[model samples]
Target chain A: MILEASDISFSYGSHQVLEDVNLQLKPGMTAIIGPNAAGKSTLLKCLSGMLRPKGKVRLEGITLTTLKQEQLTRQISFLPQEFNTTAVLTVYETVLLGRVHQLGWRVSDVDTRIVNQLMQEMKLTDIADRYLNELSGGQRQLVAIAQSLAREPSVLLLDEPTSNLDLRRQYEVCTLIRRLTDSRGISTALAVHDLNLASRYADWVYVIQNGKLRCGGEPQSVLTETLIAEVYGVEARVTIGQETRPVITVLGPVPVASSDFQSERDAGNDV
Target chain B: MQGTTANDLNQAYERLGRRRLAVVVTVVMLVLVSLFLDVITGPAALSLPEVLTALFQPGSVSEATQTIVCTFRLPTALMAVFVGASLGIAGAEMQTILNNPLASPYTLGVSAAASFGAALALVLGSGMLAWTTTVFVPVSAFVCAMFCSLSIFAIGRIRGASTETIIVGGVALHFIFSSGVAFLQYMASEDTLAAIVFWIFGTLQGANWQKLAIIAVVMAVTTGLLMSRVWQLTALRLGESHARSLGINTERLRLQTLILVSILTATAVCFTGAIGFIGLLAPHLARILVGEDQRYFIPLSALSGAFLVSVAALITKLLIPGTIFPIGIATAAIGAPCFAALALWKRRSYW
Candidate 1:
């Protein structure tokens, strides 16, 4: 296993976000899929060392919290769901910042070479000189990913990497992530909202609901209709496609209690 | 992949380099001009050549000229530079730490707290309240500033308040301190009341070697400490969780920076009284010139602040041919317009 979390628990004051969570990520893509309030992002934060847990998160047999910052940063690269650039930095300069842990103030030749190559790989060489604020959402996301990869970490943690992107950009970003995992054999854990995207790309899936792991297996076995309806409070149809991936479609509105129906109807009639 | 675009890239690089070089040159020129202007503006209006001669050959000058140029004017000018630089760096650090574009030292209530402490010292007197005013003015100011900042930090931490909340907190604290000082002024003797008012507006009339030495040492040490943490500060711009993931102790870093900024602001306020707006304006000027990298931002803010204050002091001295205005008045008069211009420029950029 490249990354492992054992009996992890976390809370924000009285609200428990994660409890007794155990996970193992091998050198492939693992998608943590769940509804908004599920402990998916929280668990990823603990594993990535962004948040501390009561138990242990070990990467390559070494405890994450005990490791030095430079060592941990070199080992794991985390791309947050939202970030703002204070300066109008060029793509190259922003990407170069990823090497700050390894290369202090002075940028080495190797650092520049890696940044240039990543920019090319992400198809960002064309806009490398453009300021971060000038780029479109898709272009900015690509630059952000390239920044994460510039560290060349063994483990990558991304939260909602495609949330703000359109459909084509979403597919493009996911494809890029898939290529990085397969070609470099880097272990990746992404908390994704689009279940179809997760089912299509993830080598393994962990279904979480209400701070507990509901199920874990290959996408085909784990994304069942009952699980979707139970967790999301929605009626959904789940079918295994010819490509061996699960296809989820929302069928209708969730059933509401009679009281809720009467109030909604009254409000609607008034409108 | 190869022809005009490659040429465009090369041209862009060249343009950026040239622009950066121009900014550097302009800053250097401004510093020199400010320094020179500071030397010439005093009771005895010496020519530029006479000013240079007096500076190089101090013993050759008459006792009155020597006292006017070296003892009185030079110390005041140096204090302006140091105060300006410290405030500028403090403002920049506050903005970066809070991740708020509008955050400044004043926005965190550091200046207000410092003014309150200074007012307490002036009204109560060091002789009567030795513990609170004499030995503890800066300390009390620092503690109050830190306390107020922590409150704002906590509020933001819970619901994750925006930059606007921090600014509002600062404004509220400003009013609170203003009322506290006003109450003290109302109860005090006429002489003591006048002194408190002067302190609030700020002045460099009492500049001395001891004050200059203290300011110099604090500015140097604080700037050095912040410079070393440039990388960590850069990581912090990514957000606290992101910073923690990179192995940085986010809480510890934030605490350390807050203490440093509080100390720097309090110390300056202790000597120069409550000089406002330099902390808010200087950092913006530095950012515009040096980009957002803390490595450049910290030093550039210091230099730019020093230059701005020095220029203000010079202008204040020159405005009244026979007398000098308080450096604080000049700073506000100059800083307010610059701030207005920055706001306008920002609005234009948005459009």
Candidate 2:
């Protein structure tokens, strides 16, 4: 599958959040790593059809803009950064909701099988019968991921899925997402805050700044000290870690003059 | 080393399925028995044998017994069960769509709006629009209830149709309608005031075969429409964004469910007046029993509602036997305590 976006631009009323950004993705795990408020989530939302951008997004030969919402959603699943489920539904019941598109008045055996398999795959079987309110933060996060997986979508879009989780759980969740992307051949784009994790788990990396793509390449080539210093404004060292993956260790914040940050934002991109 | 086998899932499904079935069957049988008892225990009470004979062989019974059983008691009894069931289903739908456990026909001011309409009609006389050749009181009440719902929706649409917006809008409407009713009571004549007050204190005395038939048909069709989208409704229980990702049109579902709830609440309360707490309590009780699967939750809500109303109907008679109480009084008297207890003491979290 090929998902390509060209001249993609978006704005919230008077503010331009994204400007003439373009990206081409194939079925693999891709990570968009950037500083806070860098428009990574906005780009992902546009690609996932949650927001309409003023450019062309094509899946294979078909245009994404022309498709109906239901059709677009069936092929793409976007999990937002924050959500609180109001219903105290069981884990299994909530996960089964992902297959609602395929099920009718009654849940089919096939639907149940897929949901249970995801619970098993996501290692949520032990807590499947437990209410969502009873689960810890990490467990709930995994359960939500399992729900997204249950859709059997060909493309997965996650917005900072590991933001609230602990370091160990963050690693675990990212690894699991990476494995699912590889095994199922599902195209995935994750907006990430952790540079090391993105370098370690992501097959392709795109560094975004001010709603524009700064660079895109393999993790080793993309995670340079200069890009980190410029994009995140932090002093950092990039070195090879276990499994030959790039590891970034931040030393301190690079305190640029106040005028630099303000000027860059004020000089809005001309789309 | 092995993942959970399909056999395990199959076993769990079977066990839960049986439990659901047992709960349904038990409630249904209880309702059936209560329905039978409710029909015979009126002011002119009859023995079990006489009641059964009257039921099984209506033609052979004396004219008086027949009138007591078939004409008066039977329709009211059936009205209690049907009205309860309809309100229950409507309550569950409101909770799912509004994403608030406290949202129901009464809490959202739909009932109060109807109450205001009924009060307004009585103050003006039922012949306010006699040329229409329809019962103006119920028609007026239904229209006002629907208008209140639409007003809430309009407010929501203008400023993001979120749960909080709609709920606050409902509360505001409740106060507005309540004030309207109070004003009508203040201005009414002595006879008009009494009639309006009696209507406000909802009853089953107005029950008859024709009214029951019309409500039953409306309920059957509306409930069918609701049941057809049971899965989507269940998914909606998750959250707006989650339902959207899972391929549900959240906006459309919200609009449709809103219209359907207005229809249910308006029709349920039009003839009956403003009965409170049943709608709020029934859905919460159903969720506790069924764990939020709308297929079971919705039907179970209906059955539980029927059980509650039937019980209330009996309480209305037995609380002070010589003088019967209006059904709303008994419903509030019974339902409020349970609702308060659940709010205070119930350990389980509903949403």
Candidate 3:
């Protein structure tokens, strides 16, 4: 396991957000899926060392709490959901900030090479000189991914990487993340809201509900109609695709009052 | 990959080289101009050649010109440069750490607290409490400034405070300190009252070699120390959580930076009274010139601040034929309008 959490629990004062969570992650793409307020992002924060957990996190035989921050950063790169840069930094300069973990004060020749290569690979070369605020949502997402990849960390933690992208851009970002993981053998853990996207891309899926892990396995095993209905409080149907992955479709909630519908129909007839 | 890497490397070098060249040229030109202009300012008219000869060879010029250049004008000019640089760098550090454009030493109530401490010392007389007041006026000022900053920081650390909350807290603290100084001024003796008032208005007239030496050594050492931590400061610009993920002890950095800024501000205030706006203006000027890279911003801000103060002093000296105005008045007169213009211009661009 590249990262492992043992009986991790956390709370904001008396309100518990995560309870007795145990997780072990290996070198692959693991999608964390859940309803809102399920502590998916919180777990990711703990794993990425952004927040301290109640229990221990161990990575490569060293306890995470004991390791220096910079050392951990060298191995793990985290992309938060939102960021604001007050400085009018260009795309290239912003991405180069990712390399700050490796290069301290001065930028070396190798650092420049890595940043440039990442920019080209991310298809941001044309707009590299443009300020960050000038970019579209999808373009900014791409630049953000490029920045996360700048340090060339062993693991990448992304919090809803595709949340802000449109349908087409969503696929493009997921594909890029998938390719980076597969080709470079980089470990990735993504918190995703879109179940279908998670099902299509995730090698492993962990379902979380009410701050506890509900299920953890392959996408086909973890993503089911019963689990979805129970966790999300919505009626949904799941169909297994030809590719052997599940697709979920939300149906309208079970009708509770026929009288209200009849009254609406009578009112329409009167009009 | 190798070819592309080489090309990128070359481009990075060229960009860095151009920026470095621009900064170097600007700094050198500004320093030369400031030095020449500063030497010729004073009531006793001495030509540039006479000032230079007096400076180089003390016996070459008359006693009056020599005393005027070396004792009065030179010390004031140097003090202006040192004090201005301290304010500029402190402002840059404050803004970066707070992650707010409006965060300056003054905005954070650092200068106000320093002024309050100075006022207290002057009104109560340094002899009242020998250890606390007399020997430690600067130390007391430093303590008060740090206290004010820490309070503002604590207010911001409260969950759900937008940047505006901290700014509001700073403004409130400013009013509190200003009122405190006013209270002190109310009860001061006639002799000490004039001195206190003049001090509050700020003047370089009391600038002497001993004081200038203290200001220079303190400002240079503090600025240099802070400059060495530019990488850490840059990481900090990403916010505390992000900085911690990058292996920085964010709280520790904050504490250290707060102390450094307070010390710098206290040192300047102890010597030059309460000179406003240098810290506010210099950092903005440096940011415009050097981009937001703190490594370049730190030193550039220092140099630009020195140039600004020196120039301001010179202009104030030459403004009237026979009368000398306080440096603080001239700086405020110039700084306020420039600040207004910049605000209007930056309104659309500031995010």
Task: Give the number of the best model, judged by DockQ.
Answer: 2
* Ten-residue region with minimum lDDT total, candidate 1 chain A: A253-262
Instruction: Candidate 2: list runs displaced more than 4 Å.
Output: A257-271, B1-4, B126-134
Which scores better on DockQ, 1 or 3? 3
Residue-by-residue lDDT tens digits, candidate 1, A40-76: 8788888888789999999989999888777888888
The residue-by-residue lDDT of candidate 3 on B1-351, one tens digit each, is: 646654764576568647766885789688668966787767887888899899899998899888998998788777888888888888888777777777787777777887787777776663565553334555666667778877877887788765578888988998899899888888877766676677777777778888888888888788778877777787677655556656677777876887788778777876676777877787777776666667778877777777877877887788897777777777777777877888888775654
Please identify which of the two predictions, 1 or 3, would achieve the higher lDDT against the true structure: 3
Q: State candidate 1's TM-score.
A: 0.86
State how far residue A26 of model 1 sits from its true place (Å). 0.3
Off by over 4 Å in 1: A84-88, A224-243, A246-271, B1-18, B126-170, B348-351
Q: Write the candidate numbers in order of decreasing lDDT.
A: 2, 3, 1
> Alpha-carbon error at B46 in model 1, in Å?
1.8
- What TM-score should be assigned to candidate 3? 0.90
- Best by lDDT, which number? 2
Interface RMSD of 1: 3.9
Please give the DockQ score of every candidate, comma-separated: 0.31, 0.53, 0.37
TM-scores for candidates 1 onward, in order: 0.86, 0.94, 0.90
TM-score of predicted chain A against the true chain A, for each candidate? 0.90, 0.91, 0.90
lDDT (10s digit) by residue, model 2, range B137-224:
8888999999998987787787455888899999999999999999999998887787778778888887888878978988898888
lDDT of 1 by residue, B1-351 (tens): 644554454455457656765776677678777876776777776776666667889888778777877888778777887888888898888877777667776656667766677667666664565464344555555566666666665655556655566667766777787778888788878876776777777777778888889888988898889988887787677666556655677777876887788678777777777777888888888777766667667877777888888888887777988877777788889988998898788763321
